[model samples]
Target: MDYLLSIIIFFPALASIFIFMMDNNVAKPYGITISLIEFILVMVLWMGFDYSNPNMQFENTFALITTYGINYHIGIDGISLFLLILNAFIIFLGTIYLNQPNDKNHLVVCLLLLESILMGVFSSLNMVLFYIFWEISLIPILYMIGAWGTGEKIYAALKFFLYTFTSSVIMFIGILYFAYLFFITTGKWSFDVLDWYTLTLPFDIQIWLFLAFFVSIAVKIPIFPFHTWLPHAYGDAPTLGSVILSAVLLKMGTYALIRFSLPFFPDASFALVVPIAILALFMVIYGGMLAFAQTDMKQVIAYSSISHMGVAVIGTFALNLEGLGGSIFTMFGHGIISGALFMLVGMIYHRKKTRQISEFGGLAQIMPKYATMFGIVMMANVGLPLTIGFIGEFFSLLGFFKSHPILTLLAGTSIILSAIYMLILYKKVFLGSIQNIKNLTLKDLCPREMTVMISFVVVIIFFGIYPKPILIPIQNSTQQLLQIMNDRAIKENTKIHLQNSLNKQKTALDTLHIQKLLKEVQYA
Candidate 1:
């Protein structure tokens, strides 16, 4: 297990160098092989991982800067274990299932580089190491969108970069400030995150620190108002670009919320729960409404992401075991569902050369194989029972409903809205009369496409029915986190924030002093 996580993180980067040297003809297969090996190694990691143990595993540490306490520390706990596997599997699938033509090996190398950075982001324990990976991951995707994307690719790429990178500078400052705080408290210079978890700042500091981190995470998740960059990026990127962006990249946000935000500022999180929940609810409704109104299929999926990810936000802010666990589960669920849907859309666009829902009429009649598989994925997208999406959303809403019934009810409305919008989109694209004469002549799924598409279909349904494999591991990790937050909250009297917030009560002393002045005057 020693250095295994390092190999997983760096193998793609090393292979990308080889891929860069290879002739164009040989690069794709070699890239696919590297990714598959990476995926298999992660599967091995999963098999060996003890779901019963909630602590970080596969610990690997090497000092890079002894004076500043920057160590190359990396590990995985139950939460990151499954994400590691998902990232590897999706990158493998993204490489194999791509339907584009290429003349140079740049795209291949970039994708591999992107995968390595993502692996580091998920598994890195040290904030400096994590920040390095996080910042570098932006470059590969930036190249992908601008070079290989569609209309206004430059605009989309820049928007995506500027939105995320600029916000992250503030986050980087927060990390350094926290490190400085830790060094002040205990005369040791360390950038370890586990050490910061023990520091309890005043309520006011938590609010400002929480906002600093929130800007970065929100832009990534593209939550509500911060989500303007998403549709343009998703709509402009190529198929595999869209797949990785939607499936994996977006998850980094919700994952950060769980990993850093809550524990770092438990009291502030509790105090702001209602306002944040309202914002999440707004994301759910507003994102879904936009999805319903889209004419382009890619835009539909892009907007739906905003709506879907809001559930994860709701679950997280619920501040309970179920809420935290379910929020993490939703991250996995959204990744799978969004990845498959983007693949299917890519397949459609490959054959039709168009992404408009209006351009895809009678797909069910013309390409039954494609239609059937597509239908199954869309059902999962709509959160139908016996599908992966349903269980995650169910648990998320179920968990949060206990804390704020009204807000949970509002957030849960996305199901009906999503079902209506998604199903309507499906019915329009797949079930209508043959709107275009060329549809009748279109070929169905080829051997390569079926192998890829059907495998994803199986994953969605199998995990949907038997979610325990993933759920239990996620729960194990989340429960440990929940225990920490709970123990801290008890000693800090955290629940008072929630009660005061709800009752509209103020704990601060009156500043106006009108009544005090009158009493003083009367006494005089």
Candidate 2:
């Protein structure tokens, strides 16, 4: 298990080199085998993980640049463990489900490269190493979209690149400045996040640095106005690309919010909570309305992602165990739900050569099994109980309600909006009588497709019913993060203010009988 983290990070890239030399016919199976091994390796890491320990485990550091105090430092805690597994799992499924006809081997290579880069992004503790991994990730995704994508593929790819890269450059400047601050204080240089966490700046400096990091994270999270790039990117990318993009890539933003923003700028985070919550609530309602208006099936899912991620962001800024825990849970839940939905859309596209919602109806009459699976996933998308989606959304809203009740109420409307749009989509696509003969000839899920759908269903329902295993570790880490924020808060007033909010929330929950109900659910 020595160097297990590094091995998990680099295995895919090294495997890609060998697979790249093979012909398309054999490359896919070889790639799948490699990805499967990677997945297993991640699971092994999980098996050996110390769940009760909130500190970073599997840590490995090697000095990379002594003069700057940068190193090849990496580790994983509860926050990152599942995301790493998610990256490995999604890419493995994506490789199995891949169906590109041209340059298939190259596409497979791109996926493998993405897997490696993303693994690094999740595990690296050094700011420089994390940034390097963060920037390199854009390349494979760009190639995937431009090379194998649909209409306006090149345009979508370029827009995605410019938006993310330009904003990330700003974040890099922040990182360098942060390191400089550390050096000035300690008389040495360091880009280690753990080191930065212990270095406190004045409120004014914190505000500037927070803004510097927020702009980049917001764009990546694709919050509200910055979200325009997403629809274009998702719409044009191939199925596998869309799957990985929605599943694992977008999370990098929200993850950074927890990993870097909050701990690094506690005073600024406390000061900015209201405005950020406003933006998050606005994103929730606006994205939902836009999704309701989309005629294209894929576009609906794309817009919905904006709304769902908004929920995660709100939970993040809630700045408590419940909120942070719910946010991480939401991230994992949305990843699985959204990725499955995109795959379903891709399946329909492959058969009908179209994604127009009005193009086909009475799909259930022709493809009962696909309809059944789609129905289950659609229910989960709307946060139906006993489905994975409901757990995260419920806890997220509950968490934020404690902090900003009115805003949480507005945010809760997204649940209704999501139900409306998703149900409408299901009714439009699957509930009608066979009107188009073209649809009558469509087949149900094949063995390969069935495997993917079943896997999604099992995970969705299994985790929904029994989420404590995941929730416990997430809460453990979030609690540690909250301690960091508390200990680092520059102003005594900021600490007291946030503590009072949490106390009032606890009292309100107890008075309303909500606490009792939650305990029942937890034990159930």
Among the numbered candidates, top TM-score falls to 2
Q: List TM-score per model, in order.
A: 0.93, 0.96
Sequence-dependent TM-score of model 1: 0.93
Of candidate 2, the 10-residue stretch with the lowest lDDT total is 508-517
Candidate 2: give the clashing pairs. Answer: none
Candidate 1 residue pairs in clash (backbone atoms < 3 Å):
none
Model 2: per-residue Cα lDDT over 1-524, one tens digit each: 76999999999999899876788898789888999999999999999998879899999999988999889999999999989988988988888888777678999899999999999999999999999999999999999999989999999999999999999999999999999899899999999999998998999999999999999999999787788899999999998888888999999999999999999999999899889988888789999999999999999999999999999999998887678878998999999999999999999999999999899788998999999999999899998877889878888888788768999999998889999999999999998787688787888999999998998999999988877778867866877887788778889977885566446544553323433545466557
Off by over 4 Å in 2: 497-524
Model 1 residue 112 lDDT? 89
Error of 1 at 17 (Å): 0.4
lDDT of each: 0.83, 0.89
